[model samples]
Target: MSDVLAADSATIGEPAVNISIFGVFVLITLVITFRASRNNKSAADYYAAGRNISGQQNGLAIAGDYLSAASFLGIAGAIAVYGYDGFLYSIGFLVAWLVALLLVAELMRNTARFTMADVLAFRMRQRPVRMAAAISTLAVSLFYLLAQMAGAGGLVTLLLGVSGEAAQAVVVTVVGALMIFYVLVGGMRGTTYVQIIKASLLIVGAFVMTVWVLGKYGFNLSSLIGGAQDLAVEGRDVAAPGAQYGATGTSKLDFVSLGLALVLGTAGLPHVLMRFYTVPTAKDARRSVVWAIWLIGIFYLFSLIIGYGAGALVGPERILAAPGAVNAAAPLLAFELGGTVLLGIIAGVAFATILAVVAGLTITASASFAHDVYASVIKKGQVTGNGEVRVARITAVVIGAVSIGLGILALQAGINIAFLVALAFAVAASANLPTILYTLFWRNFTTQGALWSIYGGLIACVTLIIFSPVVSGAPVNPVTGVSPSLIQDVDFSWFPLNNPGLVSIPLSFFLGWLGSKLSKERPDELKSAELEVRAFTGIGAEKAVAH
Candidate 1:
């Protein structure tokens, strides 16, 4: 902490690039937001873009929302530092989409009007089910958004030659403001447009970076392969997994837990699920998932070249010289290959990536608060038209504000934003996935069962994380000399694993089943069967209204 503060002080007043092309991105997105606002005339327009998004556009948007700093930086950085272990993260993310495609994308589109709660509460008790689902949505979205904001803070330092808390706070505030603007004015329409643009840029940038890296070695496959395993992993092969997954002092069960969280968690992410409602029909939603699968899959393949190139080119010392070097690898690689000009462009794409994703997350949080909590549950559907939109916009602003504040605090505390994101995935998998699966497929699933799954899962995830090694206490910090977990004074973590998915996920399902059996409370058999028909066949799904 002192070193970072000293570094922050010493690096003060360094000159940054006089003309950041990133300004062009800000200008372009704001114009898109203004244009989209003119079309947002109703609640439907605000929340789900009147369900008019095309499969192709929505696919890009989905990829934009999904690919975070985690994708562009963390994975690449991990690979640069840890050899083959880092590539596992890419697989976890890409394979998760399969679960989203098979279990969620089409069914969620058929069942929900706007949010995840609508699907969970379709045949169950509306108020309790909506409330529980709303809490999970807000939790997952807020956690994910905080990571993006923190990444933004680090990025601003890289871009502007500014370091320290103040610069980070300033960057976070500006990003928060832009995010709120996208959600308020552009709504889903504006958000999706930005997401599509961001995704397109990301794909192109990644492809170019990969080609440039290959060209660096005269396009020799042997050179590429030989040089990529440059990072030495002790007691483990550089070409095999060990540096991270199933490494020394780590359990294989932990590996399985992390994988489970990644695979199941994507299906339960509120922002991703909300994208389904933005499309007009089940077919469009399904098609969008397919499109995202291909685009994101191909995009991740480029990470290898970028990651390995960094190890072979940039090296690790310069990366760690910054506060969070893990995120700096890819950007540093950009600078290495194409100089400051190209670095600025990649930074701009990263800024857009964060903007689009945080907008999606904030809008979903807002909808969960307004649509599910206020409109449906609190007002019993009395709120309509501008009233609902007003609540949603206000909620979006609040979410952005809260996320910025938390991002600053997290950075100051020296928390790993990527690790925080992993915990969030665990929470979503534990707290939300069980309820979604039960409500969608189980005939005897009752309202009590849904509530049990939601709240019980939520509680389990939070508790396990608090008691886990990530927060309570780790044995050492390489720089600090003192332990750096949230509770620095105590080594109270009985749970060896950082991720809580293995325990929490199964517990949630078990609680759902137990609650249903204990109460002898049966769901509406007719409604359950109707949901099966509606979800699978789209017999009476919500349709896009005339715009």
Candidate 2:
């Protein structure tokens, strides 16, 4: 173990630790959590915060929702490893917010009383649509939660020098408990405030780090590119020796697939969509989306700089040996260039980023269970106020436990953080996005269509992913013995794109359209659908109230 540490230090250098920064972060988080708890009241307050959140606050929360562990740690790691291709993910992520702003945001705010299920079931009976929506929401949220939990575990273990399994268990327990407290005690009010604070700090930290990196390299674009090119060549030789790592042959296809997944997948994420609903009015929802876009765009731009900086400064060989463990790349760079204090600041910012994201995800999942499933479905819309809040709190605990369990399991599988995140995005885009989009925009969309699209797309994506050659330990070919098949003689050798969004997204649309064509429609239901559309478009609200 000592020799291994020595070798890692030789390659990656020794990472500096600052316990004081961590202590400061913990203090701030607890304070925010306590403040949010004071605002907790009835179920409405807990889940939607009485639908009274301001546009700016909600926008900040949306940014918080968007910037997850994947965005922070995974993107940096990707750029460090894959060069320009990795930055493509950041661009793709930013572009998808455009779809959110123009299409889904105001419509979701106008139509749904609370969750995504309200939008899906706006025209039809609640049971079938709510059940389908709940399944999709929970599935996507849980998958995302697992990825975040795994990331947290990895970060904790790396920072504190603890055993991996023990670190994972600790993260699961701590994050899970905090999440429950956030939802039960503070609800949406608490979650929203925490997200806003974290998002602001994250953007500030990233910008500071980016500027410092640029100054180090003299802010010359050509020089930076030259450095990256030289480092890519040298690092490739050092790591794989004679192996190419850029957009070469099949890898180009993988890049496009990944880009498609990230771009389209953002529109479908339940947690992101839920943030828009917290605002009071549809106009605020629209405004919040615009703000979120600007914020996210700025952050992604910073991410590109940080990624390149990591590639040039840290090198790929050092990043790969412990990809999941390195949380302080930006801080380490700051320390090497600036000083220890800057490193401390960056560490605090990263810690806040993790906590804010996890808290938002936990609240989103809790809402799905408490409101969408229990109050809206099982209780037949009879639940109200404090009872509903209690259920949400209970659901938070359950969801947190599940996330912890999956985080522990992920450690055993040796999953990379970025890969897990991509999987979550693929599932979200494939299953949830199609149903929500069609339900809002297409009047002819039927219950059968929504159900088929949600379940069919989900099953298809998961099935393809299971058989895809991308699974880390996927069985080796009997003859060639390579884990990922490249030859035609192998049993499966098509679609080198590991992410299913490129294929599954279109398939979901097709399934939805086909299902709508075959289903029977009632005249009264069509009238109700028209009314819902008018309401969502802001034309029928007064008349809707009059009736």
Candidate 3:
């Protein structure tokens, strides 16, 4: 990507201004972290924000965590270049939250505490169920962390004109240190505050960009779209969904599979699930989802206009001219409309975006480690109070360090992580979702069933992704001439599809039922009844530990 930038002579044109704004965003978040650390004293305060975060605030934080680099930059860039198809991704993402709202939110809030393992282990055998859930959570969260860090590393280079491997390493490690602080010191309280701040700034930035984009074309939608089509240097119709996904039966199936992952995956994500535990009541969890729906919905709707704004103002050719600048479409559009000051604001927002997400992921990963693995499995539930808090902090540092190491490698490897995010979604959907639904809804669900579903989904999703054509070769970008293949010379993908969700999701559901039927153990009817009353009515539910 550095080579690509050099080849195109791409420079920030004014690095000082961008760096100053970026620095200011970091400083403010650091102050928030300092304050949050003071109030964080117990396990609940460390992991779930002390069950005191309001619905509206958590809603904004949810938006902050969910609207990642993909939503803010990648989707907008896709719309700028590919038109309507880009907006499809936003719809899929937003629609997934509906699954969480209707089926998972309140029930999860009622049944579980710090981690998803709490829910699974509530009615099942303790150690094994926890192991399965924790492993699955680590798989999904760590994979996402790697991708986010890598994207952050590359974007740091793009945004601030930071050069060389050393500089990129410093960027990732510094980000990692702050992530450690956010997770270990500030905990969920700090993460939630950062996420809300980031989400607010993102909305404000999008509003400014939308206004400029519409104003550039006199607020005429047709003219804006027409100008966008003219900016399509590849001659593909920018007004309609393109031929790439429709070009073959396999691609169409892949599209369906990707859609499945995106739509069903949110409920299963560890970080997203942990949000439920941070609120005082089940109704608060439900209301938070509603608030998230409104905020996330408005953001995606306006993002389409931002995409069109980029197309009308920046043009697809120049966006393509700078490699890895595809993600910079919206930021560059900001630069065009409102100059360096606006560009600096977007840059800061993007940095804040990555920070909130990483902090959220770090907490979830560390909590799963502390609550599920170290405390439950290794210590046999012997750990408590500051002991658990100590383990969580250590895990956060370890996770943060590993993320930085992986981020540096990613910058050097130049791997395209576009597929990794999809893979994360697919893993969550296939591996985690079935087990959650079965445990909550099925009377006959057994320990065997839960373990099989969790392990089976995890193994199946990872294995299939490794063998899929997306990891080898499926299609090339028409404009960039770069193939979507992870390996440049390899073409040995045995899997016919790009996404594993279609096969893996159903397989997970089937395995759960089969395991339940084949197991010798009987379902614990009494425990299920106990869980049932609490899950629905919030009676005898787990309470947040007071600070």
Candidate 4:
């Protein structure tokens, strides 16, 4: 442990200007966030920016929100240690965006008002539907937020050379404060612009690193692979390149499960869906998705190169000894190739990326609690635009504080960063996606159906996660210290999939279908569902129904 700390400190020696520049960026973000609040009038303005954002701008924001610390830091670290198999995760993530384009983006833009609950309740009684949807949104968002907070804590501690606990507290307090300001002052306007700027910087920084790495190897893909292959040959197992990277060799089941979670999970994320509402028309939403696909694809391709570069140049042994601290691989690569100034630029970009994503999440959660639960459900829709904005600001502060607390706890517990992120994706796909799809496509779906679907999936997913071998600290004996699985003394082996989406997503659909069938027939439900289909397709504009 002492050696590990010394190595981490050497890799991240304090740079005065680097720290100063990052501090300035935070201040600027806060200023923009406060300025954004000026235009916010009603709840719509606070939650959805009055639905006036352009497709191009909203698309950039989507990319920003989607590319969290997991994508930027986790994937690169995985590839650095695991080789080509880690790149498979990059492939899974990029392909998941396609699911969003084909199934979710345009439809979501046309359906609900500000939140997913608005769409689900359109064809059913408001209370039960809204409550269920709000709960699902909150659960998924909170899980995902915790993962982001954990990553932020880890990153700050590594970069600033502080004790992990102090770093976690600092990141949580700074990000939480900034996020509240963004939602309170800028509303959606401030959030959207920050996302665009951050996305642009991230893409550019990645591209710069990728080009430099390829040029160093003279653009020889075969030579790069050969170098990595040679390294594998000298290792203990003398395995093939893929197997050496933990690819599961011939076991196809694990691959399939991973693919299912990553592919389906993208379309189901609440924060991503909320961005669609910012665009003006269904056509624009479609266009924005296309742009996002292109942008994200380019970046993923760059990650492939960056991952290989790390393996071939920096080597895997150096990365594993301090997995959490290696978040600086991309920036470190820049320093090795071009010197301190370039490294400083890369560091600034990473800090900006973290801020943009956390702010986007903060606003999304605030909207869910305020607009969906507080006004729409609890107040019986009595709250107007300005009133809703006030409530959202209050909720943002509360959510921010919760995130800080979680971050501090995570640092103390020494949580696994990558697994925490994957858990968030699993919960979102399981508890939220099934209901969203069924409500949109199945006319027979009832309010009771949505409620059952949310609770069933949420309960199953969380329960399985708690008992899972990974979380319980009982891997297959040799790999982990447990001689017998910890849960064996208790009773069951948890659910099969490491991610609950592999089990709970299908269960959600089944429960929704069964609930709709068992409930007393409501003939009017079908008619309402058809109307929603028309409204979502822009065939008809929906009337503003009384709450």
Per-model CA lDDT versus the true structure: 0.80, 0.69, 0.81, 0.68
Off by over 4 Å in 2: 1-17, 168-172, 233-250, 323-328, 331-335, 338-340, 411-414, 470-496, 526-535, 539-547
Task: Give residue 13's lDDT in candidate 1 (0 to 100).
Answer: 21
Cand. 4 TM to true fold? 0.89
Candidate 3 matches the true fold with a TM-score of: 0.94
Per-residue lDDT of 459-511 in model 2, one digit per residue for the tens?
Answer: 88877776565544355533223343212234553445567777788898899
Once model 2 is optimally superposed onto the true structure by TM-score, how far is the C-alpha of residue 289 displaced, in angstroms?
1.2
Per-residue accuracy of model 1 over 145-259 as CA lDDT, tens digit each: 8778877766666766655767667766876787788788888899999899999999899999999999989987568656755543334354677766775556577778888
Comparing 2 and 3 on lDDT, the stronger one: 3
* lDDT digits (tens) for residues 76-136 of candidate 4: 6556555666666778878988888887888888763688887777778888877777778
Can you list the residue pairs that collide in candidate 3?
Answer: none
lDDT winner between candidates 1 and 3: 3
How do the candidates rank by TM-score, highest first?
3, 1, 4, 2
274 Cα displacement, candidate 3 (Å): 0.3
User: 1 or 2: which has the higher TM-score?
Assistant: 1
What is candidate 3's lDDT per residue for 76-151, written digit by digit as tens? Answer: 8778877887777888889999999998999999874889999888889999999999999988987788778866
Query: What would the TM-scores of all predictions be?
Result: 0.93, 0.87, 0.94, 0.89
Model 1 RMSD in Å is: 3.0
Model 1 lowest lDDT segment of ten: 6-15
